[model samples]
Target: MSKAPFLLGAAFVAIVTGLSSIFIVDERDQVLVLQFGQVKQEVTEPGLGFKLPFIQDVVSYEDRILGLQTQPLEVTLSDNRRLIVDAFARWRIDNLIDFREAVGAGGVDAAQARLGSVVSAAIREILGSVPLNAVTSDDRTALMNRIRDIAGREAASLGVEVIDLRLTRTDLPDQNLAATFARMRAERQREAADEIARGNEAASRVRAAADRSVVEVTSDAKRQAEVIRGEADAKRNAIYADAFGKDPEFFAFTRSLTAYERALKSGNSSIVMSPDSEFFDYLRDAQGPQQQ
Candidate 1:
């Protein structure tokens, strides 16, 4: 019965020793085993691990990407405009020994803190060099790339690799928005006014051209009418001159007959006669021939 108790006690001690020595590391984790406060072994693969009981310590760090998001920062640009910027970064522990030496077992959190400061400083430096419009629109991507390059180098000394850095949001301060809108509105209004002035100038030119056309048309019509009247007058004068040149005595007799007919047709009557008058010669000749 005493031997049984001793065997049970030995089995308990062995169990304790086995439990203390055995450990497990997952695929996504790395563990550093320290002996007497010095690093003894590093288990980087997924498998069962062994260590000295009560004399070794294991520190585990994530072997996957970690994320760090920063609070929104109000930054001033070279143009003296304030902007709120929010950014984030992804990183991972590259050197476990160096990471542990520099910080502690809390590798990801410590790296995040250090990298956050570097990113903030880099952001300030880059953003402060650019104008507000450049930061908001023009070279934002390039600026971020340069910042990431600088931040990556800074983070390397902390035993971390900065995978990516991104801008989440960029905004103008509330106080500046109204002023920006007003300026935009004024610019648009000026453009509209310029267009209107151009339109009016074009319309005036068109109206002047139309007036000139009307004047030209009227002048052409008047010149043509004068030419036609002059042609008609020349034709009438030629006809009259030909008739008068052919028989001057007959032309005078016809003219005298037309004048006597117009005078007899009037309501008032007057007579003046002589036997030897040329007007009576035609009547006298007719009567004498009948008498003979």
Candidate 2:
């Protein structure tokens, strides 16, 4: 019983020592073996790793890409437009030894802080010199590439590789939004007014053209009617002249009857005249001016 207890205790101590002297290196992590605050070794590949128990320490950093989100920053453009820019970046530890050297015992938090500073500075530098439209235009792709390049170069010193820089939201400030909307509405109203004016002008021209055409058509119709009436009057006068020449006495008698009928049309319509007036000659005798 005594030997059994001693053997079990020895086995437990050995297992504990074995576990303390060894560490696992996962694929997602970069391992650094440090001896008394000094980097002694780095393990980039995944597998078993070892360090002196109670003397050396191990620190791990993410080898794969990590993310950092920056706070919203207000940037002023060349045209004096204000924009609130929110951005994020992808970064990873490219050199474990250098990362330890640069950040000391600060680890990922320190590295992220460094990245944030550099990225923010880069954003301010690039967007500050350009116009608002440039940042929001098709050239946005190129601008983001420039930002990543500049930030990546800056982050390299801290053993971090900046994979990409992403701008999440770029917009005008709250105070400027109302002004921009007002300008847009004003522009639209102006355009509408111009279109209405043009339409009115076109409509007036059409109306004027129609009025002129109506006047021309009415004048032409009146001229044709006058010509036709004159022709008909001439024909009637020629017929009358022909009948008068063929029979002078009969024609005069009939014409005198027609005049008498018109002059004495009704009994209520009276005219005072002499009994031997020439007007009564036709009524008194149709054969001659004197009674037979």
Highest TM-score among the candidates is held by which one?
A: 2
- Of the candidates shown, which would achieve the greatest lDDT relative to the real structure? 2
**lDDT values, one for every candidate:** 0.84, 0.89
lDDT of 2 at 164: 87
For residues 110-163, write the lDDT of model 1, one tens digit per residue: 777778888988888888888977876754678888878888888788888888
Model 1: residue 91 alpha-carbon error in angstroms:
1.3
128 in model 1: Cα distance from truth in Å?
1.1
**Predicted candidate 2 versus true structure: per-residue lDDT over 1-292, tens digit per residue:** 3699999999999898889999999998889998999988889999999988889999888888899998889988788889999788988888888888899889999998888989988998889888988988855878888889999999888988999888887999999999999998999999999999999999999999999999999999999999999999999999999989898877878888798779878668878989998878767775668534
RMSD of each: 7.1, 4.2
Clashing pairs in 1: none
Q: Which ten residues in a row have the lowest lDDT in candidate 1?
A: 283-292
Candidate 1 at residue 16, lDDT?
100
TM-score, cand. 2: 0.75
